[model samples]
Target: MSKDSIINNLFRVASNMFTQFNTEEPLISEKTKVILKTTEGRKELYKKIISNPIPF
Candidate 1:
């Protein structure tokens, strides 16, 4: 798959997981804004992807 498709899939899955388990956290959209704005946040996001890889 292409990079945009992969990122969209990540966002979709993250939204679903957030909805199922947590109601008190910030929306994924807001988090997405920050991740897009910061190098550090992007690095952390990469760590998350690396640690909890998707099965495909």
Candidate 2:
């Protein structure tokens, strides 16, 4: 392959790697972080759900 084609391929690979890295990150909100941080928060969330809940 030509030098120009090799450079273009490298740029393409770099762009794909960046996109994958960006999307792999979890998007957590502040409220979600709080809920996951303590047992009380988790219990409060658990209380809101019914044991025999039907699927929507």
Candidate 3:
């Protein structure tokens, strides 16, 4: 409720969010990107995807 506590809470929340954001890996992994660049990679990726596809 004090001004100092409020500011500290805000800082703590912001830092935690930023730290989590920075630590996450990219959604499209490096190998996936590399595979997507070439036809062979595309075929491989497609096959893998179809092998265990979403039920829907």
Candidate 4:
């Protein structure tokens, strides 16, 4: 799968996991990108991809 697809899948799984536990905290967010990035601008695209507000 492409990078975008992979990120989306991650979000989907995370969102579901969060819902299972009933939390508003996003599974993926700016902070997560900051924490996961190992190189500059590498995770910037994912930041935009996750901008679509996930329903709670």
Q: Pick the candidate with the highest TM-score.
A: 1
Each prediction's whole-model lDDT (CA): 0.67, 0.55, 0.58, 0.61
Model 3 clash pairs are none
Residue-pair clashes per candidate: 0, 0, 0, 0
Which candidate do you rate higher for TM-score, 3 or 4? 3
- What's each prediction's TM-score? 0.46, 0.38, 0.45, 0.43
lDDT of 2 at 1: 69
Candidate 1 lDDT tens digits, 1-56: 75445555776787787778765766666758767457566566666777997899
Cα deviation of 11, candidate 3, in Å? 36
Rank the models by TM-score, top first. 1, 3, 4, 2
By lDDT, the best candidate is 1
**Local error of candidate 4 at 30, Å?**
9.9
Query: Global CA lDDT of candidate 1, please?
Result: 0.67
Residue by residue across 1-56, what tens digits does model 4's lDDT show?
Answer: 76656665775687677767745765567776564454334366566657766788
Q: Which stretches of candidate 1 lie over 4 Å from their true place?
A: 27-56
Segments of candidate 4 deviating more than 4 angstroms: 23-56
User: Order of candidates by lDDT, top first?
Assistant: 1, 4, 3, 2
For model 3, residues 7-49, the per-residue Cα lDDT tens digits are: 4464457556766665466644667557666766656655665
